[model samples]
Target chain A: DVKVTQSSRYLVKRTGEKVFLECVQDMDHENMFWYRQDPGLGLRLIYFSYDVKMKEKGDIPEGYSVSREKKERFSLILESASTNQTSMYLCAREVGANYGYTFGSGTRLTVV
Target chain B: DQQVKQNSPSLSVQEGRISILNCDYTNSMFDYFLWYKKYPAEGPTFLISISSIKDKNEDGRFTVFLNKSAKHLSLHIVPSQPGDSAVYFCAATDQTGANNLFFGTGTRLTVIP
Candidate 1:
């Protein structure tokens, strides 16, 4: 079975602070994604990495950026944490098109 | 504008019953549909999927149906168990799929014992 792990299961950050959420996948998938889920809004993509050092913006990439320094690791960085940025962050990896994604446990970020 | 929609925000079902979660999409170009189930504090996991060419796909107790004309698809869970309680999300991809997915507002399912 494929495993996707996130650095933290819960996080709290002060306003204007920088926040980083890390994800790593055991499988050698080519595609990695970052998503934030909110109540009433569901999961919205923040960013996705197709390869090491390669990234693409998702529909809701504002205020967020991502880095892929290694094939197994992807990181989400928030330049300035805001209350609105608090949400459940998820990481996923996929091998190819139309294939189902393997997801990390998730990080619940709270910005106060 | 949200391309995918799940009208029902929450659903409750009795154990040993059938639970149906519905999803609708506005884009006609979407050719692949998938269902994901997420537990509290966990990421969404792939449940089942159906291709546009076929209307129905099944995996044990979980089955997914697609209606191209209606641009609607649904997930049916038979003999629902308490373990099935979770948030069900409907997702789609255009012909190419390439890892980008449009997801619907998830439906929280509660299976009563």
Candidate 2:
């Protein structure tokens, strides 16, 4: 079974503060992704990394960035946290060969 | 613009019955469609998937049917149980190899036993 670990299950940050959400996958998947889930909006992609040191912007990449310095770890950075940024953040790793993706438990963030 | 749409916000069904969840997409480039189930406070987990070439794919009690011309797909769960209650999301991916997925708003399913 594949395991994806998220650093925090819940987080609270003040507005204008920077936030970092970390994720790690046991399986050496080539693709990693970050998404934010909001009510009635579903899950929107923030950023994705295909390989170490490689990154790509998804549909809603504004105010968010990602890092992949290691093959097993992916990090999402919120440049300046705001109330609108508070949402359930999910990290997923894509297994090759049509196996689909494995996702972490997710981190529920609240910005005050 | 929402590329994928799951119009129904919620669905209620009785145990031992079938639960059908529908999804639609507007992107013609998408060739792969997937269904994911997510429990409260948990991340979404992959449930079933169907490629564009195949119209139907079944695994145990779960089945996914795809209609290419209509750009629509549906997931059917037979003999629904209380454990099947959760939010179901419809997702699609294009052929670009970017691994980015477009997802719908999801449908919250409640199974009454």
Candidate 3:
């Protein structure tokens, strides 16, 4: 089974502080993605990396950045965290032949 | 603009009955649609998917139906079990990026025994 693990299950950050969410996958998938799930807004893509050190903006990538320093690890960075940025952040990895992605348990972030 | 829409916020069905979750997309470029199930405090898991050329795809008790002209897709779970209760998300991808998917707001499904 494909397993995606997140570094933190819950987080609390101060407003205007920078935040980093880490994710790792054991499936050796080439594509990694970061998404924030909000009530009534669903899951919006923030950033995705198809290859190591290569990142692309998704439909909603503002105020967020991502890093893929290694094949198994992907990180989501909040440039300047705000109360509005507090939400459930999810990390996912996708296999080449299939569109189904394996997602992490998710990190619930609260910015006050 | 919301490209994918799951109008239903929640749905309830009795155990052993069937649950149908619907989704629609405004973008014509989207060719692949997928359904994912999520439990509380957990990430969404891939349930099933259907391609544009195919109208229906079934895996076990789960089936996905796609309507091309209408730009709509629906996921049906037969003999709904209590364990199936969760939030289901509808997602789609276009030719431009096979890996980039747009998701719907999702529908919370409840199965009562």
Candidate 4:
């Protein structure tokens, strides 16, 4: 079955460390997104890629960057992790204009 | 500023009753609306969606209603079950079709037996 998979279910990192959250989709979707879910903030889009090597910043792109070198893989990088950045990171794939998203299980990253 | 908003932070409903979640958006350009359900420690899942042309869309026991004139939309869960309890997020996208969605703060629904 087609799915979006995250490399880690949970991660713990110290402050000032660089963290990478990986996502891969087998559906061959042209659009992939990264979001951070907080208690009251909901899902804030961090970044998205509409095609390979093409990326766009979302509402909350600060302290974060993305790499989409391949069609199936999208990686979210936190250059320097901080306690305030601790949140659940989600990856989603959109197939054309379907208007629905297939989301990964998510990675819960905790910065100490 | 937040383009989409869910005023209520939480809602409680009895099992077998209807649960209604409301969402409002300021962007008139948004033409597609969707609702998502999420449980703890898991990613949110797409529940239902409605286009701007239509007023309502139903799938199984879930239904979504859109009011373009009012810039509002709602999700109704009939005979809400315990398993249906989760955080529901409302999202919208405009005509650009770039797959960019603006999401609300989300409402946590609890079904009491």
- The lDDT values for all models are 0.92, 0.92, 0.90, 0.92
Candidate 4 chain A, poorest ten consecutive residues by summed lDDT:
A93-102
Question: Which regions of candidate 2 deviate over 4 angstroms?
Answer: none
Error of 4 at A67 (Å): 1.1
Residues B29-72, model 1: lDDT tens digits: 99899899999999998889899999999999999999999999
For each model, chain A TM-score? Answer: 0.95, 0.96, 0.95, 0.95
Spell out the clash pairs found in candidate 1. none
Q: Write the per-residue lDDT of candidate 2 for residues B3-110, one digit (tens) a residue.
A: 999999999999999999999999998899889999989999999899899999999999999999999999999989999999999998874676557789999999
> In model 3 chain B, where is the ten-residue run with the lowest total lDDT?
B93-102
True contacts kept of 4: 0.70
| lDDT score for candidate 1 against the true structure | 0.92
Ranking by DockQ: 4, 1, 2, 3
Instruction: For candidate 3, write residues B1-113 as lDDT tens digits.
Output: 88999999999999999999999999998888889999988999988888898999999999999999998999999989999999999988874653468889999999999
- In candidate 3, which residue pairs clash? none
* TM-score order of candidates, top first: 4, 1, 2, 3
Best by DockQ: 4
* Tens-digit per-residue lDDT, A16-106, candidate 1: 9999999999977778999999988999889999899999999899999899989999999999999999899999988445556888999
**What does the lDDT come to for candidate 4?**
0.92
Judging by TM-score against the true structure, name the best candidate: 4
What is residue B102's positional error in candidate 2, in angstroms? 1.6
Listed for every candidate in order, the interface RMSD values in angstroms are 1.7, 1.6, 1.9, 1.6
